[model samples]
Target: METAYIETPLGIASISGDEDGITSVSVTKESSEKPSTKIPVILQDGALQLQEYFQGNRTDFDLKLNPAGTDFQKKVWDELLNIPFGKTTTYLDMAKRLGDPKCIRAAASANGKNPLWIIVPCHRVIGSDGSLTGYAGGLWRKKWLLDHENPVKQQSLF
Candidate 1:
């Protein structure tokens, strides 16, 4: 029922929720205006958690989420949560996990509609060919998030 904005590496993320639980989180282009009011008491923690996530100081989110969506979309988003940090999965893979071997398109659609953003980790979804694909926040941001989570550490050349 309330919303707050937090500056992040990708952009300014708009977080919305209530005392019951978090309902939505979406990113936007950079903004200069400050929040009209303080982030609601119920949502301040969630906002801070998101800040930590973008800072690479946190990987797993531990707050409650209440994203609004259809039953099928909820199912797909739940499956997306199973994708671990620093990992990726394909849409076809998600479809199979949803117990429908042919629902790849539907699964992809749900993935695209995920409103929880980083909390639900929809950016982890990719094409079956190991290619980075569609992302509502822009593919560049997706690539940035993936790289942040799975930085390629240099190895010794012995």
Candidate 2:
């Protein structure tokens, strides 16, 4: 496995991957001066894609991903990918879609464990009441991402 740290708009992001594909991406408030492993090619591609996304030139990510998690977590992550850009969904809604409305908490927990960050679209999930909830990247960055994707048009004010 290889790892690298990328400085993004939100903060310093740690990227890790191997031949199987990118495994994890975590955003932190502090920078990592040294990584445990050499940077990999897969992570290099992911970093480029993230840069494009922040620039608003990319809506969907194309890099290969292989997030490590439990079976249920993988299912939740897969469902998250279906969430379109510029849109949002609640944990309850996702739980209902999964055919288990009572599993909202589990769904939320799985969403929180998503390792791919924006590429996995975990930021699109929110509270049932439409309020922003817990975000691993911090609520402010979550708000920024959601607002960036769903920009308020000038016509809306008119």
Candidate 3:
């Protein structure tokens, strides 16, 4: 797999992929990354889309994802893509929807392993009581993403 790093508001996002499609989009613990020049041909469009997303011009992504995981993990990740922009869902709801409430832990585990980060929308997942939960990218970044997606517009009083 080929890898390239891009600087984002949250941190450095390491995007990996090839002709088979994107395999991963991860936020590194590092706070900064050098600016990109020419991206790989296969991953170029995905890079552009991500930049647009951060600019608030995109509510959803349109990139081909090829996250590598087990079948169960793939199922969980697929469901995550269904989560709308600016909306949130609980792990219990996801587990119930998958038709196996008992697999809640497994589901959560799969979510934790999601390699496609923002592109896969794993940040939309939360605790059952509407609280932020474990995020591979960190909870602060999760909150920032949610807030970025659904910012509260202040009304002006003239």
- What residue runs in model 1 are displaced by over 4 Å at the alpha carbon? 30-37, 154-158
User: lDDT per model, in order?
Assistant: 0.88, 0.87, 0.88
31-114: candidate 1 lDDT, tens digit per residue: 774543677888998998988888788988999888889999999999999999999999998999999979999999999999
Give the least accurate 10-residue stretch of model 1, judged by summed lDDT: 28-37
Candidate of highest TM-score: 3
**Model 2 C-alpha lDDT versus the unseen true structure:** 0.87
Ranking by TM-score: 3, 1, 2
TM-score of every model?
0.91, 0.89, 0.93
What TM-score does structure 2 among the candidates reach? 0.89
Model 1 residue 132 CA deviation (Å) reads 1.1
Clash pairs (backbone) in predicted model 1? none
Q: After best superposition, candidate 3 residue 42: deviation in angstroms? A: 0.9
Higher-ranked by lDDT: 1 or 2: 1
Residue 34, model 2: Cα distance from true site in angstroms: 8.0
